[model samples]
Target: MVAIDPEPLLAAGRLAHEQLMNDACTITRVGPPTLTRGTSVLTPGASTTLYSGACRVKPQRIPRNEQASERLTVVARYEVALPFSSVATDDLQVGDTVTITASGDTRLVGQKFAVMAVDFGSHSTAWRLTVEGAT
Candidate 1:
């Protein structure tokens, strides 16, 4: 049996996924707020762009009983997937922010989110990000 290269196959799969269901997303680095004397100032930082993106943002799914019993405030959680070539995996950290444009709604543009986790597949050309609402 001869060996076959998987790079081309992976690239094709990524392309198909991108073209079919991807949107635009921006990942911005979060830096510590600067403190001057006795005051603290917060500001936005540098950001990188991803042309093809997959973002899932919705309210946390929990049983109504459980939510009420625990007094759990269900907030929106975001999961974003991007092609491996878009940005370096190392550049995305837990504190980074991701702003994604809603696919069909212009009124929901630039929804902000905070990165909670970053998962990179060992053999896949994609990055999966788990995020939550950001202030």
Candidate 2:
């Protein structure tokens, strides 16, 4: 499923897809639905939640003692690139569940911001996401 802006300039991206235009990650928010980052056919200025198949999920089953300083291992469900900046920080842990949808070949990686926000250019992305709730 892709999201299209109520207007008529966006590309209407496809959800649940794996695209690698840049290293950044695009995403779909919870409400007001805003494609903060990445690229999409949906309205460029209309707030919305865009979906894409670009996520970083890790399964961490470490003991309590090892939780202090252990890195989580992640895998990409699809052969696609998410949208974002150089850094991504979120509370999502391993074994969490997430969903990705899209309207085009754009992608974004995010898991902490309730409100999505991209650069001045809709194409600027450079972040990764770690969504939880999936085993």
lDDT of candidate 2 over 1-135, digit per residue (tens): 898654233322312122334233344333334563567545434433354334433323332322225755332233223434323323322322234332243433333322222214353232333233211
TM-score, candidate 2, is: 0.23
Worst 10 residues of 2 by lDDT: 110-119
- In order of appearance, the predictions have TM-scores of 0.65, 0.23
User: In order, what lDDT does every prediction score?
Assistant: 0.63, 0.33
RMSD (Cα, Å) of candidate 2? 17.0
lDDT of 1 at 124: 66
Candidate 2, residue 22: the lDDT equals 26
Separate clash counts for every candidate: 0, 52
Q: For model 1, state the Cα shift of residue 57 in Å.
A: 6.2
Error of 2 at 41 (Å): 34
Most lDDT-accurate candidate: 1
